[model samples]
Target: MSCCSPEGHCSSAETAAVPAPGTTTVYTVTGMTCGHCEKAVGTAVSALDGVTAVQVDVTAGLVTVVSTADPDDARVRDAVEDAGYELAGRATAAAH
Candidate 1:
C-alpha cells in the first residue's frame, strides 16, 4: 500500500537541513488529512528560528521537530495555527 491519501497526496518527512545538535520534540496536531496538510504544517514549523527538521505523520497526527534548543511551545502552536491546523500540544507518552 502506498503511504498516500485518497487524493494522491503523499506524506513526507522534510528535513530543513542536517539536524544540528539539538532536541527533538513531537507535537500532536489535528486536521491534517493529506500531504498538503503535511507540507503546510512542515513549512510553518520549519520556519521557526531553531528548527532543523520537521516530520509530519498525517495518519498519526504527529509532527516531530528537531531544533537547536527546546522549542517554545507557544511559537510552535502559533505556527501550526497559522498553517490552518490546530496544535493539540506536545505528544503525550500514550500518543506515541
Candidate 2:
C-alpha cells in the first residue's frame, strides 16, 4: 500500500500502479477548480455499488473510478452531477 502524495489530492497511487486488479473507468468532468471539487466527485462516485476506489484530478478534469464491476453511464453522469459538475463524458485518453 502507498500513501497520498503531498499534493493532498485523491490519487490512485495509494491503491496501486496502472493495470490494477479492477475495471478502471476514466471520466471527464468540467468546472472543477480545486481539490475540494475533486473530493466531491470522488465521494459521489465511491458511493456507487461495486466501486472499489476513486481518484479525482481537478487540473486535468478527470475522475478515474476503479470498480469490481462495470458501472452504468447514466449512474456515472448522475454521480458527477451530484458533485456539482457536468460530466463531459468518458475520457478517451488521460495521457496527452
70-89 per-residue lDDT for model 1 (tens digits):
99999999999999999999
**How much lDDT does each candidate structure score?**
0.85, 0.75
TM-score, every prediction: 0.80, 0.76
Candidate 1, backbone clash total: 0
lDDT of 2 by residue, 1-96 (tens): 113346665432222333477998888889876656766787898899988888777777777888888878899999889878899888896351
Worst 10 residues of 2 by lDDT: 10-19
Q: lDDT of candidate 2 vs native?
A: 0.75
Model 2: how large is the Cα RMSD against the reference?
6.5
